[model samples]
Target: MERISFCPTLAAPLNKSEVASSRNDKSQWKTKENRPCLMVVGNDSAAAGTLKEALGEWGYDVVAARNGWEALVLAGRRPVDGMLVDMDMPIMDGRTMLSELRWLGHQMPVLIMSNESDEQVHPQLLMEGAQGFVLKPPHFQSLQQTCRKGFAK
Candidate 1:
């Protein structure tokens, strides 16, 4: 049988306290403990919303940022299990944000999402410590598998 974790509705009106309580209740659901939180960064609101939905459905706590600077701020507040960054963000590009995250001593893996999925971009991004690259309109299978592996407990 397939395993399913807790993923509340994206449009749900639950307050933060309710969500936090649910997250802490291990035995409440027959799911694993400590599902990873995801921070998604992109300038496109639509894409960000879509990914937010996907990640939420995949049973991850989802947070969306419109740019790298916002992502950085969110990342600094708490250690997230994974990140999905869009290369063309305002103020800071994906590469720059990635480097800054590294400089801040963050060891979390980053996945870049962009329109241009050049063959060399993956290698280049990886060289800067990014874990992987996901092309825009990410494949569901790839996204699920990568996130699972990225957040393996």
Candidate 2:
């Protein structure tokens, strides 16, 4: 199994008052305990590392998982505010992971990140549950905005 490295620049945890205030308003966008917790699942170590770094720079606390199975275990142990999952991987693919996650009652917003073009991706993934889809080597700003939108609602 490959190692998953996390960036070391995460923001401090949120205080109780802050959590209370954020939860009081359903319309307000809440960060995960001050910094949003993002789980990034992909098979390529280099790509996942790059994404982890970028997301960390953007103020997210990121957890990198090599495949969907690993992602599921990580998600089960902690609360993830959002997820960015690759469409293809060994052990478990993103689509199956999404289906399993939904069946298990995990409603965390998921964004599919794949090498496939929009036309190549299956429509069922979006219709079934994914909050959004992003092409691999995503534009940083666009990815960031998509993440923000997922957390907003």
Candidate 3:
């Protein structure tokens, strides 16, 4: 499947203390370890790597899963503040993953990413418990805006 290629200038990862202090009382950005973690699920290693590095630079602790199964294991094992999932992947696609997550009572906001046009499917995805849908080649601004709103509470 085609993936978005992002060109983010690498930024330093946030230290544990920095992550702790940066979060406010209202922010849902804390995990069991008290650090915010975001899970990125996709089969595109190159894209996932770039996205993970970029999110880390922005002060988020990022974890990656090559497929839906790995993602499910990680989420079940620990806290995930949010998720950025690609629509097409091996093993399981984004829709199925989202369904399973919700069925298992995981409520963290999830955003689906795809190269497909956002004409119809996004509405259905939203009904299925997604926070939003992002078209591939997603601009950082849109991603940041969407994430901030989702994680604000």
The lDDT per prediction is: 0.72, 0.75, 0.74
TM-score of each: 0.74, 0.74, 0.75
**Model 2 over residues 46-146: C-alpha lDDT tens digits?**
98889999989988889889987777666655667889999999877888778766654567899998887766455778777998888888998998888
Model 3, residue 37: what's the lDDT?
Answer: 82
Error of 2 at 72 (Å): 0.8
Off by over 4 Å in 3: 1-33
Residue-level lDDT of model 3, residues 1-153, one tens digit each, is 322111122122223233233333334445555656889999998999988987877767899999776776667665678999999998778988887677656788898999987678888999999998778877988877877777655
Collision count for each candidate, in order: 0, 0, 0
Model 1: per-residue Cα lDDT over 1-153, one tens digit each: 321212221122223333344445434333254567788999899888888898889888778888876776666555577799999977778887787677555677788888887887779889988888787788888989987876566
TM-score of decoy 1: 0.74
Name every residue pair that clashes in candidate 2.
none
TM match of model 2 to true structure:
0.74
Mark the regions of model 2 whose C-alpha exceeds 4 Å error after superposition.
1-33, 118-122
Error of 2 at 5 (Å): 28
